[model samples]
Target: MDRNAKFIAALKRLQGVAPIQVWPATVKSIQGTNCTVDILNTDLIDVDEVNLRADDEATEGVLIVPRVGSLVYVGAVENAVDNLFVCQVSEVDRVEVKIGNSLVTIDKDQVKAVRDKCELTLSDKATLKQDQTTIELSSGKVKINNSATSLKSVLDDLTSLLQNFTVTCAAPGSPSAPFPATITQVTQLSTKINQLLS
Candidate 1:
């Protein structure tokens, strides 16, 4: 063939090769760990039973499951429908990273990290929460808050320690009456403080 004809034939062959399809999709429904989504493009309509991307060797099974209506990425081998797969969950308005049950989300106003039942945040101040307890770190001090019963128990323990405290004079000889009087005053002060705490 002439050079121009050979070049044209090569171009035709290249056009025949199918290209991989990747597009953003909206999650429709979830069944177990699998989900369905509607692709945003006109070529592919909808994909069903798409599994969420998770670690195969994870002992905790699937932890992070995308909610319905969230955006995600879908991929397929050329135009093969059965080979379609959910690549990753896409954060539409924020940047989020998830691994198993751990998640970190970042936005213009705040940053949050969560793992299991614990959540940590960093913004104008830093905060952490585990179950009902919260610890906030800001302005060079750490403030912890817990259940009322827990705080009361701590106070009770302090009261008991103070009530049972004994002061002994370090002198080799018997202390004078003034020393004994000072000890009595300290014990009375401890009792008053404990009563106020209670």
Candidate 2:
């Protein structure tokens, strides 16, 4: 009739004498790579120690950890409930991918990447765009658009010039000298700028 009914019928036909090896379940709790779930059947049955299936196999692949209260499809091998594992999930709490020495992880709040070395060689251009701002790398040069430059070297030069600012005056002491508290104010501003930017 429907997709689920058709799928179950197909499984029944294929398995013949064996019990259905797949069913929908709701995640109840998680313990490492294993989870506890309430199998959705005529009667709710709580199954424990179910493994979460991921492509990970030591060296490389992806792993997705399901969140509690998420709907998942639980599958078993050879109709054995003891071999139960989550084959699919409707929601995820975390996802991680690994390849050789590189790793990328994504969670609710942030995405992190770790690698030994990363290199990008583009024939034409490589651009990183976010919102309305863009950074482009082309022909061994970097260009930033719609964003203020916060380069430390440029800021340092401006800070140095401000610290050494002076005006020529014919009056008393020194013909060329900065205003009394200009160096202190400039130094404080430079510190704040460095704290706020790169």
Best by TM-score: 2
lDDT of 1 at 80: 76
lDDT of 1 by residue, 97-189 (tens): 766788888766788999999999999889998887777889987666565434444556557656765556667796634456556756655
Report lDDT per candidate. Answer: 0.68, 0.71
Q: What would the per-residue lDDT of candidate 2 be over residues 1-198, giving only the tens digit for each residue?
A: 999999999877978666547899999998867789999973656788887754223557777889999999998877787878898999999887778887877778656565654422233566555444455677887765444443444466576776677665767775665565666656666765554454
RMSD of 1: 9.9
Worst 10 residues of 1 by lDDT: 55-64
TM-score of each prediction = 0.39, 0.53
Which segments of model 2 are wrong by more than 4 Å? 1-20, 42-44, 54-59, 117-157, 162-198
Global Cα lDDT for candidate 1? 0.68
Error (Å) of candidate 1 at residue 70 is: 2.7
What residue pairs clash in candidate 2, if any at all? none
